[model samples]
Target chain A: MTAALIWIFLPFTAAIGLWAWSRHPAQSTRLATLLCLFLATTAWLIPIGKVLRLGPLTLEIQPILLLAGRRLNLTDTDRPLLIFFFTIAAFWFAGAQQAGSHRLFIPYGLAIVSFLVAAMAVEPLLYSALMIEIAVLLSVPLLFPPGERSVGPGLLRYLIFQTLAMPFILLAGWALDGVQANPTDTNLIALASLFLSLGFAFWLAIFPFYTWVPLLAGETHPYAVGFLYLLLSTTSLLLGVEFINAYGWLRNAPQLYLFLRWMGAIMVITAGIWSAFQHNVGRLFGYALIIETGFSLLAISLNSRLGVEIFTMLFLPRVIGFGLWALSSSILLQAGRSMEFQQLERVAEKWPFASTGLIVACLSLAGLPLLAHFPVRLVLLEQVARQSPLLAVWVLGGNIGFLMSTFRLLAVVTGGYFGPRQPGERPLQITLLSIGALSLVIIGLLPRLFLPMFTGLLSAFTRLP
Target chain B: MTLANLLLLPLLLVTISTLIILISQNWRYSVLALALQYVGVFWLINGLWPLGLAVVKLVAGWMACAVLSASQPAADVREEQTSPTAPAFRLLAAALALALVVSVEPSVEARIPVNRFILMGGLLLISVGWLHLGITTRPIRVIIGLLTVLSGFEILYAAVETSILIAGLQAAVTLGLALVGAYLIAAPTMEETP
Candidate 1:
């Protein structure tokens, strides 16, 4: 536990120390890159159940830590979550070095990681609002590059929507507290359950509240967008799990779960349609996130341990896939000096490796068969069918929309034969694409290997009773 | 007053101030109204010290407000110096304020859910300020609106009783945001003849 605490805090401390030393940009970048690598490595090395002992006390570093007044727990279920965050942190750092944005990226990346860890460590019922706020604030620097155009309006909008969602979550938490005080308080529990689900819907950026994601994506660098999306989706899903785990009464609220299912289905379909029409590469990434989040919501609305397991497994591939996509896009934007689809279209053949990676990532994201997303999609579909056949149709439509959008980009990237191709090839680009494509195929073929780990993680929540 | 009342009263005051700013036709009152709101927030933080970790926050809020006020431009130099107050602004503010106050004071017989009420009010005020800033073309007005929203959020965050680490991060992020806002306003892209 102490080691985990130290591991999370070290980068955060380094971020501050590096910021104060920002006059020496090179030194700051070097120090931050080291910290990022250190954090990523430590996250992978830590055993799932290893508890750290300090003198007279022993603290377990699992998902749940029951302190005197607050609970700081990380269950087996959270293993994938921690891995997702740290892995992204690591990749963002590496990509920043390659893209020459390390000075800004490192500090924001560390702060983001610290905020995510803090979000995960705190009990969701009590601290969801604070978690969202921290995530929002951490994103500001990343969204608006230093000395770039002001992201004031965009940042403010993000803050407002997130803050607006907080009251519902806090109120729901308060209601849950009331129910805990008296288990017979069905009325309070029901209201709390409804509010909590709705609050999560907003927080997760479903439909109407999702405007901010695209705006931020359009304005910010791809790496920043990836980081923000990862944090929001993963943490929001975990918060949903925590809510269900903490409130047993919520399990019986079939109507609320049904609402969530339909909501998720609508989000999936709408996001898919939205992605189909987007011209900007950044907006495409934003819509893709919305679609992915829709799948996660579908998994959660299944309201079973199986649903939880699938949701947890979803994060691993996404972290790798999105990281690659963001890196590729960042490279393309830098090389082309614009994020416009027209500029990107011209260089598609020139940057063949990056273009390939982007295409593969889009396919994986769309849940095409024989890719990383297939297994999870199959499970989610089965669960949705079990709930309602109409839901299955909705999920299918969403899947098709996602595929169509990916194909749209793939078409452009393969070349419309309209512009001259640039010269020069980088080995690292090829390596990244190959690794991404290889992992997608490997995971698609052997889904069971990943299933057990996520299942074990989900089982911890059921043990709460 | 009971410990609960101590918490509830200041929150009520903040909510009322939010309503005043929201409903007032005179945009000039917003800064004063927001500052007054923070003063109420200061009182709540002082009263709720026994909740643990709030003492540090109370002191921090005081220092922040002191520095901000000292550096802030005088009202005479504000962008709205010659603008006429609009009835539409007053109506919108009034409606929002009324809704917020009504919601905070639930019909049920209980001390208003202090923590939750304050949080809700803070969110509402900030969102309003955000909208005002986003829609306005004037740079100075936009900056003031953004600052108002941020300060409103800062007040609500003070009540969270976060760890020292989280608090420090929050402060740093806030400062960074301010610097970014200032830079944007100063940039040539933002300049226009008013």
Candidate 2:
């Protein structure tokens, strides 16, 4: 319990310290990075299984706090969830170190981690909206580092949409509370469901609400963009899961399930189509994430234990793969003069390892066979097909769109024929690329290795149903 | 009412004050508005004494306001030379404020504690201010607007009584973020017209 608390709080504490230290020009970036690593590792190493006990009482650390007349019990399932969160935090720290992100990265990364943990731990759902808003606000410094040119409109658009989503979520949580008090209140349940779906729709940046993703991609530093997308996408997916887990009524609602499925399918198809035409690599990544989110929604829409299992399994590989992709793209953009495809046409010749990493990562994202995404996609498709073939077709169409986009990206990277490599690239780039490529290959080759672990995690949640 | 409701009062006040700052046309009044707003918030939190840390935040905010006011150059002298629509704008703002207050009343149940009412009113005000600030082109107004929003959120933090430690931390963060905003305003972006 102490460890968990420290894990969550240390980042926030360090952020303030680093922000103060940042004013000093002589400050060592290495010291900040080492400190972040230590804190992140400590968080990752804490054992999550045992419930803390004191005398006759037991306590569980969770994202939600339920205050029922002095009886404070966290939800039972949040233990494993915390473990997952800490693990991701560790990976983010590693990525930050490898990328040599700006000086603000250390503090900003810590702040984001703290915010995400708080978002996960907050109770009653309404607080999640507020927490997410705080996360967005914190993200601005990361997105538009000091000395960068005019701030991207994407940040503003992101703020507006996210803020717009908050009221709906808060209102829904309040309405859900009313329904929970009176279990058979269909009217309250209906209102809660509508508000929640609408809120999530906005939060996920699905379909019509997705302009910010691409716009943000256009303006953001690749590494910052990567972190933002990962945090938002994964957290939103978890929130969707938590929403279902918390409200049994909504989970059982057939109409709600149908709505999620249809929306997911629509989002997948449209985002995929849009992605096929994107020339900018960052926007391409954004569209791909939008499609991936659609897949997650499809999994939830299935309303089955296996569906949830597939979703859980999908997270790790996607995070690793997407992080690699984002980091590589960031390096490419920094080294290359422009983000346009025409400029990137000879990227393979210029940066061979990075080009390979980008290609592999894109392939993994497209769920090509043998990549980490393959097995998850297969399971997701099977589940969808079993329920409805039309839905399956929609998902496949999205997959095809992802495939087309990847090919476009690949074509640009390879420049039609691989040429001689450029010299004087940093050794760090080589190391980052090799690790990313090796991990993708290993995970793709042995999907079963991680699949069972995720399946086990999913079972814990499914048992409640 | 519950202690939860009582704690929420400060949060509401801060929010309302922020909104007032955002929409207030005269830059000079915005700082005064924010100061008065923070005072109300501090008083409300001080009354509850939910967490020992609230005192620190209240003090920090007071100090920040003082420093900011001292450091800032007088409101653009050019504004006085260029415009005479201040009264009409103030009148329009007052009308909007009235509508906002009226609109929020239906949402607030009578059972809610009086302190919570004040807090809620403040939050609404701050949110309005933030919206006003975000839309406006004037750099000073934007900073004031953002600060008002932060203060409103800080007030909301008071109501979250269970996690006193987290609330205090959140308040500190709000102050830091506000300072950053102020810094941005003070050092105008290259894109902004001089």
Candidate 3:
């Protein structure tokens, strides 16, 4: 049996089965959590391409799976990626119970996992673009659950942007088909770079293409959008890394690095400026995510071992940051409070845990000291300063913008003045909120605690500088 | 019809129908024109695959139109809703798209193995479709624009690379787009706010 069958197909079949068995949101959440946890644990414990003796039987998982004239190669190199994705899935699935997403979230999320892994695994790698597009097609239903009478323009825009990206990336792949033999084909490289940049920009929601992020955040359920953003960005970033891994010219191009850094800075600076002036917390959700994307790009642009290390370090903190934001904001939303400044008056008095979680999450996203995102942001900034002092200032300016937004958000949640206090937070919610916030603070103070888990994944991109 | 004319017929149909869809005041005619455009796309795909496989493209397009038509308000009364822009805007857009397709086709053909008719038709659809997307606030209209663009992409990609996986994916995308479009049309409160 192929390892792809075990890791990819098995989960896919089970996801569908679970969906068929029950559409109850709570039941689906629990089942999905268990399934994702199981998948994640198995990925960590079971090494592929190794024979194991089980009582009288011998079991081994082969590395390749051939389906419909395509190959899915699950090599030892892919082990870390699988573990990373499944672990990420487990984290979100575990949150589903608290967030109360629809029943289809797990099933659709599982199927999305299969499709994304297939995109990575599929040979004749151009097919990955199609695979990714299929994932986009499925996301429509997931994002706009067939509820009654309405769908958001944000989801449509999201779909359109993602769809627009596919043709460009595929076209780039087609253009770069024989680039290895003709490395000096400057025209080909230019065309491919243009196509690739546009594709990644749409995928990453950089600069002008980022308007949909805030719209979707305000429109969709916060928890669903959070999961959607994390999965989409993580997968696209991996694919972006794969692009660099495949092409020596793209990797070595001094101009490309400069472009990435410039674009990253722009994303940061813009997100910062916009986030600061935002009156709605839902809108802040989008800006915080864009800030994370900008930071990730900046980390990649550093083009150093430490840069890659920082990139890896950025992951766990991001998961925590986005999770805290999604869960807290969702809790507040369920309590029938709008995220708008006027509506949010005295909300903190009613739901302290939810309010506190939202603030800490935003603060962490802003890279505040003693928050989860601070350590990685600090390392990345130090690297940037060594490269250029002026750019470092701009980068600092961006974070300060986010910090201002968080301050505004804190004030809004806390109120212009402390109003009438209620019977504080539910114990379960307070406990969860405390754990999430404490982790951020603790991880910031001692970065080593969570930094080790990421080191192994960094080695996967061995080709990166 | 001669083979040469058969080759030209669908392209002509596609161009005429898309132009009408772009400039027309009535939504019903626009939907019908989109279906006609898909038929043109299917003929273009015929050059790349077996007749059986090519039929999927036509089926998907027609099905999409059907779904859109179903969601549309009943057509007993006559009400024509023109675009906010002058008809001159479409003409200008078409001319620009024509310039783009004419300029880009030779290079596109050189890089990718596809039928010239398909390439030109698809390129035209893609170019005009992008214009349509950019100008519209209407969700259903935007979806039609997306279908137009994807029809172009599917024709080009199916020619360059032929496999069951991509074929299935293409069909699924078409079906999904139609579903989303239907959902949008039925949406009680339109979100053209963005």
Please report the candidate that would top TM-score against the real structure: 3
Candidates in descending lDDT order: 3, 2, 1
Error of 1 at A221 (Å): 0.6
The candidates' DockQ values read: 0.16, 0.09, 0.35
| Cα lDDT of model 3 by residue, B145-177, tens digit | 889888888777776666777777678878788
Q: Which regions of candidate 3 deviate over 4 angstroms?
A: A416-425, B1-5, B48-52, B73-80, B83-85, B110-116, B186-194
Number of the top-ranking candidate, with DockQ as the measure: 3
Q: How many pairs of residues collide in model 3?
A: 0
CA shift of A22, model 2, Å: 5.6
Q: How are the candidates ranked when ordered by TM-score, highest leading?
A: 3, 1, 2
lDDT of 2 by residue, A1-465 (tens): 443355456667877887778644225344555655665454344334457677999864443333332112223345455556556655655566445466676677667777776777665556777677678767777777766655556765675566556656766776787788998877677777877977887788976888888888877777777777787778877887878877788777789778888888888888888888888887888887788888888888888767787778888778888888877876776684466787788678878877788889988988898888888888899888998998798778877887898898888878688655563246877887788888888888998887667554453355334
Question: Chain A TM-score of each model, in the order shown?
Answer: 0.87, 0.89, 0.96
Candidate 3 C-alpha error for residue A173, in Å: 1.5
Question: Positional deviation of B152 in candidate 2, in angstroms?
Answer: 8.9
**DockQ of model 3 vs. true complex:** 0.35
Per-residue error at A199 for model 1, in Å? Answer: 3.5
